[model samples]
Target chain A: MTIYENKYRITYEAFSKFSAKLSKANDKAELLEIVQKHLKYFFNFKYFRVLLKDEVFLKSFHVFHNSNNSPEFILNEFFSYEEDLLKNHIPIQHSSNGEFLNNYDQKLNLNNGKLWAWYFKYQDLQLCVSLISDDEKPFIVRDIEILNLLIDSFVTKYQQIKLKNRLHQKNVNLKNAINVIEEQKFQISKIVYNQKNTIEQRTKKLKDQNSKLAEISRLNAHNVREPLSRILGLLEIAELYEEKDLKKEIFEKIKTSAKDLDHILQDIIYKSNNAIEKLSSKTPPTK
Target chain B: MMPDKIKIFLVDDQKIANFITQKLLQTSNIDCEVLAFDQPIQALDAVEKDLPNFIFLDLNMPKLNGWQFLEQMQKNITSKVIILTSSSDPADVEKAKDFPQVISYQTKPPSREILQELILG
Candidate 1:
């Protein structure tokens, strides 16, 4: 193949590999790792760093990659330059300084390098990406397109993971709320059932007491008056007849009836005492 | 035809109640012929034949209670019935309301004043 066609063909092949690996990524770490591995094909940079925020999830991701090393994934950590870029919504291109490189020049093995950074807003996600390079392995303006594609694929997976976590939390919360309500309903029904039992018991006891009281009142009236009426009648007759007639005819009957009345009253007192004792003996009902 | 003197029948389970009531009738100076019977079964037969002016019937009895006597008397009940019980129980008084022939309900010891009012008045 000719050199021009080879370069175009290799570029297409690298992008296709990056897209396929990014699509298979399950999480944020996997997405960043895939991008770090394939990004070298598109550019020859010493370091590439990205600060990304998902506004919907309220989470920020920091992916820092040193060429020929595994990518480091830091959550919600941003450099001063990255913060400045985010605040100003601006882009920067300057000669490499430790401040722009977040004071990591000794580890990155860089001196007299060029630094490039840009801020971007895409569909509720804000991203600021920084690349460090020197004359030996220079990063051109055209390489920004490949960086943009890598960020887009990484963010898609990150947002999905965030949404899945949130959905699971919501489901757990809903289930617990339903369980609490069911437990409360069961307790309330138990209370109601106990109350019903108490009411029925009280009603039955009151009926028994009422009937007993009625029997006592009715019995006393009849029993007490049976002899009492006779005594009153004899006295009335005694008052009518002469004193001599009273002694023989009325007095004997009066004595017998008065004795009978005394016996009936004694019986009534004993029965009333027993009834009162029975009423007080039962157990008290619960609230 | 009406009798020459007022006839009062005393029907009760207690012999003493009938005796006391009969004596009260004598003491009251209300000139009435009093027929006293402890046995209500016999009293009902006598009452049916005599057809007295007033029948003073006691409530509680052995074979024939005052209510049973009243029911039996439904056929030949020409006389006025006076319910004479130990106590004027509201139940007894209310039941007496159903009998049109029962003119008065009196609680015993048969008072001369009550007897005088019933026969003479």
Candidate 2:
């Protein structure tokens, strides 16, 4: 096979493997590890850095790097340079001789070697990648093209991860709402059951009271009539008497009969008051 | 001419009731020999020896109530009973009708008109 054909085959195979690993990454940390592995395999570099900012949270920045030392100095200079590039709406592909090249070289102590810098904006994210090589060979246009394609796929995978996280959070909220509704339903049914029991008890009490009143009514008709009838019979006999002594005797019997009638009336009143007190003393059910 | 003497028996728990009933019978001036007993046992003993033509009985008593007296007399004696009681209850009046010897039910104190009608009948 020709050398050019073999190079194309190797690039295709590497990109396919990187995509497979990227798809398996579940979070930001895992995605960064997969990106670092692939980038290191594809290029020769003494220093590599990725600086990213999300438009939604402007102050928060993510920095990923593969250097033994911290890349804070390179990050500070990269953000300052990024402002001008964004104003001009220009995508950057810079080597050693480019403007702002000295800033990265000085901060990273690159010893005047070749550096490849790339800037890309994908939806809400601003991304920058930088690589420093001590070799004299400059980066080719083909390398920039491959870097841009990889960045595009990385942005898409990151957005998918964000969407999946949001969907999971919404599901948790919905489950909590359903649980609250079930608890309310159970409480309402319990209240209804308690109310039904109270009503049944009250009805039974009222029925007993009604039967007692009926018994009192029976006594009024039967017992009270007895004394009243004696009084009436004595009056009938008194009307027929003429002799003074006999009339006096009839008068005494009439007085005794009248007293008996009065006593029966008092008994009826006493029983009726007792029934009233029993009814009034009953307490209503509380919540 | 005086009518033939009609023998009458009176039984009651109350002494005043029996006295008043006896006086009312005498006031009526009927040609009758009336015998009064406050205790139903004494009246029952007299009734077993000589059954009277008519009996006036009170229902509410301490022992041997008027109904019991009637039950005892109903088997052998053919005397007519007039239930003279303080109770004017229709249930008591209806129960009195169950005895074949009971001719009438009257509430106390027995009036002159009722005594006269009973003696004449």
Q: Which candidate has the top score in DockQ?
A: 1
> Tens digit of lDDT per residue, candidate 2, span A211-267?
877767866875666666655656655656777865576777767867877888888
Candidate 1, which segments miss by more than 4 Å at Cα? A1-164, A284-287, B1-3
TM-score of 1: 0.66
Backbone clashes, each candidate? 0, 0
Native-referenced Cα lDDT, model 2: 0.72
DockQ of 1: 0.51
**Native contacts kept, each candidate:** 0.74, 0.44
Q: Find the candidate with the highest lDDT and give its number.
A: 1
Q: After superposition, how far is residue A189 of candidate 2 from its true place, in Å?
A: 3.6
Give per-residue lDDT, candidate 2, residue A220: 81
Candidate 1 docking class? medium
The ten-residue window of minimal lDDT in model 2 chain B covers: B14-23
RMSD after CA superposition, every candidate: 8.0, 8.0
